[model samples]
Target: MDNKINFKDLWAKQTSIEPNPGDLLLQISKMKRSNLRKLIVTNLMLVTVSAFIILIWIYYQPQLVSTKVGILLIILSMTIFLFAYNRSYTLFKEDINSKSNTDYLKELLAIKSKQQFMHTTMLNVYFILLSAGIGLYMYEYTSRMTIFWGIVAYGITLIWILFNWFYLRPKQIKKQQLKLDDMITKFKKLNNQLEA
Candidate 1:
């Protein structure tokens, strides 16, 4: 008839507990598959857009040297980004046959490092090249419009770029960082348990 709660029973009955190794591994696998799918989709979309741009260039046959340069810059930026991004694919491919947790951890660390570089430096370069390319490309068409309309067009473009840079980019980076960090932390816990 004692009213006092038993600490042992309370602890034992607690529902919130750390994920088991099998569950953790399953989650990691699922995340990996999801990430791989996202990577493929992103690459495919970029390639399709590049092809569309090339088709437009061939069909429209822009006369201005600036227009040609602009198109080249856009395509070059996409190519560079894709190349950098795709290099990480090897890590995913190799991870399947990873011999040990240590090897998998190493791969995860390498991926995190690469993603940091992509999120920061490579992304900045891509955005800069894209902005410059768009500006140059728009000149040919905008030149035929009234000054006010030209200004409006440029302003709209600038605003859109700014919104993506200041808002969307940070949000996306944070989201991805959180996901990777969670997986890394969980993997580290599992690794420590194995080591101990």
Candidate 2:
């Protein structure tokens, strides 16, 4: 019996095969892209709201100390948001440009991890500054209701920071790092196969 493999048939069979590790990595990358998009949109909204508040303060209470302080806080928040927004955008673009699958996957995961850390840090900083600014405003305005709300807001922000640090961030980082390691192992296996 003569045995001969048809190249086209083999190619078609391979194409029809169920997706494996590589496809999963691509799916993860797409999910990351979507997540980054959502983050950018949310940051834009925050920036817009902050700008609106500053505009209102400028028009209504240009000379008020509380308004001035609010403006400063808004500016600080915007700056932090901008840093995260721009870094994420750049990383997304770079990931899109990467031609090698393994390299792209590794770089994308690193970028995502870094972006998460930076985003959290910026948010924590913004909340802390917000708490201080709000507290100052309440004290200067001499309103019991304002002071109560400010304290509540500060408490909520502190709790958020604690929850993120203790519960969310560590788990997220570990998950991402595990994914990256798996991808690396798969890549090494593929390389070894090619060598063999």
Candidate 3:
């Protein structure tokens, strides 16, 4: 008896190895829904924190123009980011009705474009605005603290922001892009199979 592996058997198995198209579409839907849920939760948390900060600014009624401007900037940045984020969520939620794979692919591409924009240019603007706003806001508050403690507090905040901007953010962006790319690839494959 020949000990050689049956290449013909392997080739035949490969032809039947395709995942069910229905299962794939279901998986894509589940991924989209999970992403939507995460976005909503994140937005809610951010909005809550921003509202708390704004309330503090309003209640204390600080006389410092810099403080006022800083608070406003912080609020503005949060609002702008949330608006863009919600818009992205809406795009993701729009239509999963895979009437044709082409339509589904179009929506996925749109989301990928928006995700790229959010992670790149928007992320930079967001962090910059947030950092500057926090720094300016701290100007008035830190004035009440001892010099050393004030410096320490500011140092910690700066380091945290820098870490997020340089390290965490890129990792997050790459992970998100990879997830989207995987979904896109799966859909494209399904489309090819359907057409075939």
Candidate 4:
């Protein structure tokens, strides 16, 4: 006579642990904060750059139609982009955790869709317009410079823009999308568990 227990029985006796609802909300809040911080930094940089360019146009008084047009276009594009970015964020309340899970998920899904549209369509157009605007704005200024200096200026600008477009932009989009998708998955899992 031996006291023997099967592995299945031992497993059955183990207590089930569910994810803490509060913890989930906290994690979601952290993600939202991080995203907002990035957006703010980006927006500040844009505003600074736009202001600097406007000042240059005002002070230097470049005597070319193209320069004026370029400067105006670049400033316009920057303003538009910044406004759109800020407006989209305004749709998102500060504390997503304040809402019920169903409501939170709904809002999150809406955010995901808006972000996708902005990243996929609006941003690319903005980039193109900005690039063209800069090229135009610099045309008058660079025309007076030596070929080497002009190339250097445009080359540096192009490289920076390219890096943002090809590298940073994609990385950010992927990371954000992953975070949202992961959170959505967890929410679904929790909902299912409740239904069960």
Best by TM-score: 1
Off by over 4 Å in 2: 1-9, 12-44, 59-67, 143-196
Please list the residue runs of candidate 4 whose C-alpha ends up more than 4 Å from where it truly belongs after superposition. Answer: 1-48, 94-104, 185-196
Tell me the tens digit of each residue's lDDT in model 1 across 132-169.
88888888988889999999999999999899789977
Query: How well does candidate 2 score on lDDT at residue 88?
Result: 62
What are the lDDT scores of the predictions, listed in order? 0.82, 0.66, 0.81, 0.81
Better of 1 and 3 by lDDT: 1
Compared with the true structure, model 4 gives a TM-score of: 0.62
lDDT of 4 by residue, 71-190 (tens): 888988788788778867776656787888777766676676776677556676777788888888888878899999999999998998889789977887787678767876776776
Task: Give per-model TM-scores.
Answer: 0.67, 0.51, 0.66, 0.62
Our tally of clashes for model 1 stands at 0
Ranking by TM-score: 1, 3, 4, 2
| Winner by lDDT | 1
Of candidates 4 and 2, the better by TM-score: 4
Better of 2 and 3 by lDDT: 3
Off by over 4 Å in 1: 1-42, 185-196
Residue 106 shift from truth in candidate 3, angstroms: 3.5
**Candidate 4 positional error at 102, Å:** 4.6
Give the per-residue Cα lDDT of candidate 1 at 138.
85
lDDT of 3 by residue, 69-96 (tens): 8888888778878877787667656657
In model 4, residue pairs whose N, Cα or C atoms come closer than 3 Å (at least 3 residues apart or on different chains), thus clashing, are none
Candidate 2 on 81-117: residue-level lDDT in tens?
6776677667667535545765655565566557657
Give, for candidate 2, the lowest lDDT window spanning 10 residues: 135-144
